[model samples]
Target: MKARDLIVLVGVIGIVLMMVLPLPKMLLDILLIINISMALMILLIAMNTKEALEFSIFPAILLITTLFRIALNVSSTKLILGEGDAGEVIKTFGEWVSQGNIAIGLVVFLILVVVQFIVITKGSERVAEVAARFTLDAMPGKQMAIDADLNAGLINEQQAKERREKIESEADFYGAMDGASKFVKGDAIASIVILIINLVGGFIIGMAMHGMPFKDAANTYSILSIGDGLVSQIPALLISTAAGLIVTRSATKGNLAEDLSTQMLAYPKLLYIVAGTIAMLGLFTPITVMSTLPFAAILAYAGYRMQQNLEQKAVSEEQLEEEQQIEEVRSPESVINLLQVDPIEFEFGYGLIPLADVQQGGDLLDRIIMIRRQCALELGLVVPVIRIRDNIQLKPNEYIIKIKGNIVARGELLLNHYLAMSPGYDDDSVTGIETMEPAFGLPALWVDEAMKERAEVSGYTVVDPPSVVATHLTEIIKKHAHELIGRQETKGLVETVKEQHPAIVEELIPNLMNIGDVQKVLANLLREKISIRDLVTIFETLADYGTYTKDPDILTEYVRQALARQITQQYSIPGETLRVITVGPTLEKKIADSVQQNEQGSYLAMDPGTTQQVFQRFQEQIGRLVQSGYQPIVLASPGIRMYLRQLMERTMQDIPVLSYNELEPNVEIQSVGVVNV
Candidate 1:
């Protein structure tokens, strides 16, 4: 072990030895001096510490010091009863400090006990107990504040972690102090009992064993015992005062001395009042003028000087602020910093501010977080943090969602009203203003709060204003999630995969296909509203077919076929036939024939008129399937699926176009409609 550690270990062992083994007079004196010195050191350190957490080891120190003092008491009691001379320190305290009077020494020792045990120890224990309770109660709030700061970008992850750890430490420190205070209380009680035992036992031993008379033995042993008690109680009192200071200390940027000087003497007016009071007392009361004049004069002069210093400090601070503002204006980088844009922004009008404000019972921020988590689970992509702010240019009840600084969706809401939409059946009985749902463009009405129950009873889905906005925002993010996935996000996903399947990642990344190629493939899947949550299967498919082609679209198709079960489960209901629209033999043949290949890539080479005709027929078929109450999914051959999807993307973005190979074997496919040309 290191020297410091060995010394500490030896010191602890020595404390144990003091209780059991008798020591020489010189050694006992040395230990007594050391105990006094250690207690003073602890008191000074506690006073200087700015925060309790800075002295987190204080509880253990308190325990060790209490034991050390107790051991000293034991040794002193043994010597006084056995040999009539405990040590020079104790004998000198008895003879010189107490004026050779046993009664005087006993009174002094009892006063110290009362001050340490009744005043300092009792108060410190109460404060520590209450502080520990308050700290524990406020822990959840402190943790939430840290989380809020982290979410608002006020602090980074590491800083948040540090703050959380500090909070836990503060709780633990106060709790330990609460228990450690009891040790001090016990030590005080033990001191009183030990003193009685020392005096009684010493008197008995002096008369019976050493042949001394009753009065002589009483005086001699009582003086020594009171001296030892005073010696121990003085340090205990100092240590108790230190414990009180520590537990009651508030968190500040400076030590106790600095805080007291700065705060207590902050105002010169208070000192002026004190000076006036002292002068008034001297004149009116029977106090001599000479006695109080100097003190009053000193107070008046100090107050005047403090007032001057305060003015000068204010002037200096103003000048510094002005200089800082001028420098900020002169720096070109300050102007350039304003050009930065957020990845996703949510702008609401003034009236809609209450929807985002927590004080008004709005949980829009929390809902947005849940939306991001839901998207990550369903779409397998991390949604960017949505920055919400108020924009006065829009209508009072209007809000908009922006992706990369461009508005993608806008909606209007009535804060006090609920949006109610019919579930396919017509319900005109509920009276309200007619509107359209921004998310799906479905016909909806803004109904009164009193009409919510009636509307729901009428087979209409009822939603609040915040839920309306949240639903709209959720849809917009899912639709544009592909654009949110950049190279950095792709790298994070690769690293995440690498953590679990390192061999697969090493074999595929930068060897067969780079990160960009993998990103494109993932983006393509996301663009089709496919979940990339099964990244292991995705990477394995890429590694197998990536050697043949570097095209992201082709790679996406391979990945989709590999994830056939997931894709099938996504669209089809369990134990039910999958109703879909299909392309006829003639149209399929035409689409297959139109497929062409070049050095760049394979693409559709069909004429515009024929493509238009095919799209019209496909739309008609989809409309018929929708009218029959079946959600339409187009199933095409593998060769023409991508081309057909590209043709219909602009018009039928919601309808998924899947290839035949993408379907699972156990799922039954029922052809509800077919496109003919």
Candidate 2:
């Protein structure tokens, strides 16, 4: 057992000793033992643990056991007035009782017992309340994971049964505590009735013990000690025991047991102190305070203090709420102002062509050309031309080159199986991956050249690429892994993450099952082809139809093949030479905003070369739309308006810049028919 438990055992023994011995002589020992036990118990129980059973049972058992022991020793004869040597001691006790000392003793005993009972019942109810609140806001993903686990045959029926049982047991246990909320009203009446019974019993018993003739009139001083000690000790013990039992029975299985044992061991210290002090007062001094009156005054003072503290706590809470409101009002602006460059300027990309400025379009390609003209009109510079390459499977050389290039730059260039399986290069050749290396090196060299030119030119520009850093990946892993991964990986990864990914270890994420990088790359490919439902269905089948965990990589490649066929059909762009005219600031802002809002951080600034790559991504999305049997077209960013003007000027530059006020008469009418101008 714990040291606190040991201390409680000592206290119990000491209390038993005090009751058996003469009261005044052993009182100090009793008080000392009780106080030590109470302190130790409180300290031990206050430490948070997975199982929280200390609150309810401890108070009940401790107070009741102490009270019961004390009650057995309580006698009316101890308070009777007499004229003899033993009678002198009795007279002294009577005088103490006549004074307020006995009342102090009685109230102390009663309060300890009543409070214990309240703590037990109320504490249990409080735990239930907390559990209910916790369950209410639990996410749908948590339930979904449980369902997935069941379907996957992870946990057996018995284990599931036990889990439900535990949940229900906790619920019912707390429900019982709600009934205990009514016990406070019962305690008030019980206390009053006990007081009356004790007073009447004490009067009769004291008269008989003192060997005095039964008088109808009461000896107020002599009967007072008897009334105080009897009522306080016996009734208090009964109430505490009753409360403990009620709370214990009502609480979840095993809840009350721990708390009861603890309380049974701890609370008697207060009683011991009160008992010792009252005994000391009787022995050492002559007293004149009224017993019941002092008790009543103490009770009133305690009530007042409780009320004051409660009011203060409420006021503190209100002030904290007001402070939070004030902080919230300023926080958003503070976050905005903290950045030196305007966030809005960064949100909108530099360029896109709007269609209104375009002269004419007769086909799908012509329509795209019109969009290009619109972007030139809106932004001052040449529009960056995007050429989409849909469903182009990466050769092994391409994968190796991308991988090596990414490694040099401390980044990852992930490739799906279609790329690995592509028959563009023979693996037997020296530096088989060397052919892939050129794809990235050429871009890097172009970026370097552009950077140098931009330094020389006033309006030099380039596009930015996507930011896929370790920090972002860590966050995704923590959130999605729980939903995606199964038991073995979950158990292993949880520990691995704690050691390696300390930043993300605590995050509750969606599980991702066993398929790793291969699956991610495969999904990216499928994202370009299949509709969302088809992709979800394919993954479900891969998990259910075949052996999944052993070779997820191969399964990933297979899925990518199905995705590749769809990709080649819808958006196959055929081109080699690409042209790009970098756009100006105003249109850049508008386009960037559109991308930020619509896509999930997919668009990032890059070179005119990177624009071609972005078009490829767009082609995949458009392909998915087409295969799903929808006519798909990229919505030109607003920045395209400026670019359209340039395109028109190259074809026919005589037209003036159109104003919003002149749209109906100047631009729209001219496009519809011959204009008077």
Task: Write model 2 residue lDDT over 1-677, tens digit each, in one string.
Answer: 99999997875676566545544423433442443354444434433222433354444444434443343333222322221112233334444544545555456545654554466445544544555455444434455566677778997777766655555544454444444444433443444454555556555654666554544214553244434433333433344344334443433334444655445434434544554565556556675345434654554555466556667878999999999978976787757654543101101011111111244321323444554464334211122222222112433212111111122122223221101212233233111121121222221211233233332232222222122122222222222222233344334434544575443333322233443532443333322222222333344434442444434433443453444433233332333111112233443453454332223322333345544543444445545644554444222223343333332334233222221221222111111111110
> lDDT tens string, model 1, 1-677?
99999999998999999899999989999988988998899899988998998889989999999999999999998899989999999888787757967778888888888888899999999999999999999999999999999999999999999999999999999999999999999999999999999988998899999999999999889888987987788788888988998998985788888998899889998888898899988999999888787899999999999999999999999999999988987998789866878889999999999898999998999999999999999999999889999999999998988999999989899999999998998776788989999999999999998889999999999999989988999999989989999899999999999999999999998899998999999998999899999999999999999999997888888999999999999999999999999888898888878888888778878888988898799888888989998888999988778888877886778889999999998999999888867
TM-score of 2: 0.30
> Which 10-residue window in model 1 sums to the lowest lDDT?
94-103
lDDT, each prediction = 0.91, 0.38
CA lDDT for candidate 1: 0.91
- RMSD (Cα, Å) of candidate 1? 11.0
Candidate 1 clashing pairs, residues 3+ apart or interchain? none
- Candidate with top lDDT is 1
